[model samples]
Target: MRILCIGDVTSPKGVEHLRQNLWRVRKENGIDFCIVNAENAALITGASVNDAETLLSSGADCLTGGNHTLRNRSVYTYLDDSEYMLRPINFGEGTPGHGYTVLDCNGYKIMVINAMGNINIEPVLDSPYSYIDRVLEREAGKYDFAVLDIHAEATGEKAAIGYAYDGKISVIFGTHTHVPTCDEIILPRGTGYISDIGMCGESGGVLGMNPELVVKAQRSRMPIRFEAASGAPRATGVIFELNESTGKVTSIKRIAF
Candidate 1:
């Protein structure tokens, strides 16, 4: 199956760019599913319901999130009701939304799992690695393919998880750093792995934030409000082809537009 996995959508501009370009990209690439990260969208611009809707309208089948998933209270209501939206699985047993979602595209059943890293991130109920194993154990042969979104800070931790689940899962893409990594290759076990998919927002700014404010805060060592960068926005992601028979990745490529 052809799947498009986008990195974090940080601001409204990123959403707009996706809305404008995603449909065409999907058609041209023969993409069957599109998964995007939306954790930083709301945090970068307060509340971004429009951004979320735009992403879905643009062709994203599902949206995943990380530490900033709960930054906006409005998303709480949506998370409770939207099946297409997911948060980290390690958020404890009573979390509102599901950490993973299963979707039927044509005749293929695709399972998308979202997990947050523990290193330098907020404390959660359980370790993501263990959580992923539990989920996979319960739904192993039930799905045609399994995709994982590892929202993390440390590249080592992300790489470890990808390798740990190497042959078990189809694709494992990292997020949270907003900087795309050079490593994009299929694991020995046939799983597609990328250290990071990067962010879809301002390319000139520092990790999608306004450079001026970031520089001021760093120079003065004072708390300052960060704003989304304003300029020509870009989109970043990865495309993966999975083998239906073995539930492994056949090939993977990075996408930057």
Candidate 2:
């Protein structure tokens, strides 16, 4: 089976760009399951119901999220209502949506989990390692394969998760930096790992935000209204093949189009 892990979608432009190109990417790459992070889908804050619907209807099989997922209060209902969408698992028990979703496709049961790191993030959550440990104890055996999308700032934490789970999870990819990392490798235990998958928005902008806004905020040390760039939007992600019987990752190829 082939799985595609998409990076963050920063704004409306990102959403529209994906809608226009995602289907073709899926076909060209022979993707069986696709996961997209749409945390910054709502103009650099959070995603909306319409944004999630557009992404799902386009090509995303399951939608994963990061820290900005709950920024939009209007989408709170959709967060609770949609099974295809997910927030961070370490957000704990009372969160509106599930942190992981179990998807059944073509007779294969695949588990996709979303998580956030706390080193440089807010509302300090529980340890992602501990949360995933509990999740595995309860649900890992029942699924044929597992994918962990760790939206984090520190590379060490992301690497730690990959090594901790190793053969336990088929694939582990990081998000939130909006910059694609060069390290894409299959661990010694057959798990696919990448430091970050990059974003699906403007390739010319500063992490999907307009360069002007980012510069203003950085130079002035004041809050600047950040907005998504209107440059040529591009798609970024990774495609990997996994074994059916053992549920181990066999190969991985990065996709940037």
Candidate 3:
């Protein structure tokens, strides 16, 4: 089975870009299932209900979130009701949405987990290592394969999780950094791993935001509302081919444009 996981979508243009191209990308790549990180899809901060609906209708089989996911409170209800939308699992109790979901792909159950690393991240919650252990144990025998999107800043933290869960998960990919790493590889234990899958947004800016605005904020140390860049948007992600019976990744390939 083949699965594709996309990085964060920064703005409306990023969402539109996916609306226009994702279906074709899926078709051309023969992707069986797709997961997209869209916490920033509404604007530059948080996604709204419309953004979620648009991404779902466009092509994503599931949507994942990061630290900025709940910034817009408008999506709370949809997050609870939608079986395919996820928030960081370690957000602790009483959070709006779930951190993981089990998607039925034909007869196979694919479990998708979203987790955040605490280092230099806000509202720090449970340790991803411990929370994931609890989750894996609680959900045991419930899924045929597992995949995790570790939303984090530090590359070391992402790498640690990848190594810790190498044999336990089918794929482990990092997000939130918005910069693609060329180190896509099949781990020693067969899990497909990448430090970061990059992002889907305007390409000619600083992490999808307007460069000028970002520079202004940095230079002035003031509260500046950065806007999405106007350059052509592109989608970046990685595809994992897993052995159906073993649930181990057979190959990993990075995709962009």
Candidate 4:
């Protein structure tokens, strides 16, 4: 199975780029399933339902999020209704949205799991490591492959999770930092891993926010509202091939264009 995992779509501009380019990219690459992170799609703190629909239309089969998942109050309602959207699995047992989703890509059942990092982030339900172990145990032998999106800030934490799940999962990609890491390799166990896939937005800006505003906030140490950078957009992601029978990754490559 071929899967394309995109990094965070930081803003509407990033979303627009995906809308314009995703289909062609998928077709040219022969991708079977696509996943995107949409935690920062909203103009403000909360995202719009239209954001989710736009990503789906852009060829993403499933959408996942991190701490910003609940920024938009409307997301609470949509989480209950949508099967393709997932919040962090460690957000507790009663979390509105699911933490993992299984979809049929061609004849293979692919499982996608979303987990959040606790270091320097808000306190959530449970530890991400424990949560993932539980999910993998329950879903073992039920799916053809499994992919995890470990949205986190600390690179150490992300790398730890990647190593821990090396053989068990097909692919483990990180997000949230919005800066693409050069590390891209398949683990000894056949799982593909990267520290971060980066963000799809203004490459010239700070992360995906306007550089001027971010500079001001840093220099002045005052509260300043950050806005998405407006300029030539760049898309960032990774593509991987998973073996159906063994549920392991065969090869993985990074894509930034």
- Residue range 1-257, candidate 4, lDDT tens digits: 78898988888888888999999999989999999988887743545689899899889999998888887888888988888888888987666788998888898888899999888776554679888998999998788788999988889999999899998888999998888898988898888999999888766789888899999999999999999886799989999888777877888888976
Q: List per-candidate RMSD values in Å.
A: 1.6, 1.1, 0.9, 1.4
The candidate maximizing lDDT is 3
Candidate 4, which segments miss by more than 4 Å at Cα? 44-46, 123-125
Tens-digit lDDT track for model 2 on 1-257? Answer: 99998999988888999999999999988899999999998876789999999999999999999888988888888888888999999996777888888998679988999999888877688889888888888994688899999999999889988899899999999999998998989998999999999998876788988899899999999978988776899878998799988878999899898
Better of 3 and 4 by lDDT: 3
Q: What is the TM-score of each candidate against the true structure?
A: 0.95, 0.97, 0.98, 0.95
| Higher-lDDT candidate of 2 and 4 | 2
Q: For this target, which candidate reaches the highest TM-score against the unseen true structure?
A: 3
TM-score of 4: 0.95
Q: Ranking by TM-score, best first? A: 3, 2, 4, 1
- Clash-forming residue pairs, model 1: none
Against the reference, the lDDT scores of all candidates come to 0.86, 0.89, 0.92, 0.87
Worst 10 residues of 1 by lDDT: 42-51
